[model samples]
Target: MRITLKCLLMSCSLLIAVDASAQIPTLAKCTRSANLLACVDADGNAYSVNTVGSTIYLRGFEVIGKRYWAQTSSRYGQLTFFTGLASDGEAWVGYSRRVGWTTINRFSSSGGSSAKFTCSRIAGC
Candidate 1:
């Protein structure tokens, strides 16, 4: 009976750890100004977005190297879609609107992860 209890506790602990690691981080209190969007995640990690010509770039937090996203929408559209690949070859896709939130997804070899930010325009974009 003691052996069975020990095994059950160990199994439960392992399951808990896996669930915690699978959680996706979220960004809040985002502000957009001109060509840049700044945000802070729940864990207090900072992230920013910038546009150079027609390419969009995301930096900070889990980013390990510079990656540029290609725009996939018409310039006249209210919403924009972007896709890119991380330095480590992870696929990323994101979308945002002129007056709403932005959502980004990363497809990694070990499953995947995502982040959503509540965005507000600040002017001069």
Candidate 2:
């Protein structure tokens, strides 16, 4: 009984860790491509992105390499964007747009680049 309980606890902890990993997003990353800055999905698909210094800004993201998406800390109270996503040698960026300010929370590494991103100007955010 004791061993089974310990195993259950360990499995539960591992599950939590997995869930934590899933929460990360990759809106930023370094790429070997041109155009100075780029964002990539975890599978290795790369997209051009705009960055300032160390942080990827709210703008400069393009979908299908055309329409650009952007956000600003001042203008929009809340915002959300894509990060690199990779799995099994495939890369893609799942996109979402949210705007409004809200509380910033801790970020995870494997959560993807945008996982460390911010959203401001939330309605109740």
Candidate 3:
């Protein structure tokens, strides 16, 4: 009985781990072997960046992506961004194929580009 219980617990843990990894948004071509060029801000919210060697992590309390891009905040009329698009003209593009390491500013319907830095390690590069 104990062995069976242990097996079940192990299975559960494995399942949880898989789910957690999927929860975070990651780039396809952003392989660890590649070099991390840039790390963007997270929608004016809390975010952290820890880089060791060539691994850069853009961790947030409720944020996940290859990178983050911070923008104007809006409690009642502020802007924000989700996994894909920006809420009210805000976005955090961590890893992109065509653009490479870039943080596009989406302040409005016409979000301008502050900079479009490229990362050689990225897939497209």
Candidate 4:
């Protein structure tokens, strides 16, 4: 009877630990594709984003990629215009306040070049 009681207690403790772990907050994720940034919160809400230096700003619902640059920061490469209310959303973009940049392949407006890429996500939403 003592052995059975000990096993029951152990099982209960394990279950409680698992439940507590699940309750912990998880890191957010952000995916970058060409000129667009899509961030998903821990609760799974999607939003558009823009990054300048180490700061990320949440933008409108949709982003239009007029052009993309390769292997360079957007600030130096070209002028990017963002339209819509700048609001703070739940999602975070790539290690908040860290210096990181992504390059986008931009083709000439005349369709002279075509750069194709699939969207990929990185941690720290």
**For model 3, how does the per-residue alpha-carbon lDDT over 19-47 read when each residue is reduced to its tens digit?**
23456643312123333323222222233
| Candidate that scores best on TM-score | 1
Task: Return the TM-score for each candidate structure.
Answer: 0.33, 0.21, 0.19, 0.24
Point out where model 2 deviates above 4 Å. Answer: 1-28, 31-38, 43-57, 62-66, 75-125
- How many steric clashes does model 2 contain? 37
> Could you give candidate 1's per-residue lDDT for residues 72-109 as a string of tens digits?
22223555555444334555444554544332221212
Evaluation by lDDT, superior candidate among 2 and 3: 2
Candidates sorted on lDDT, descending: 1, 2, 4, 3
- Runs in model 3 with CA error above 4 Å? 1-44, 62-94, 97-125
Work out how many backbone clashes candidate 3 has.
3
Each candidate: how many clashes?
Answer: 0, 37, 3, 4
Better of 1 and 3 by TM-score: 1
Q: Candidate 2, 38: how far from true, in Å? A: 5.7
Per-residue lDDT value at 110 in model 1: 21
The parts of candidate 4 lying over 4 Å away from their true place are 1-23, 51-57, 60-125
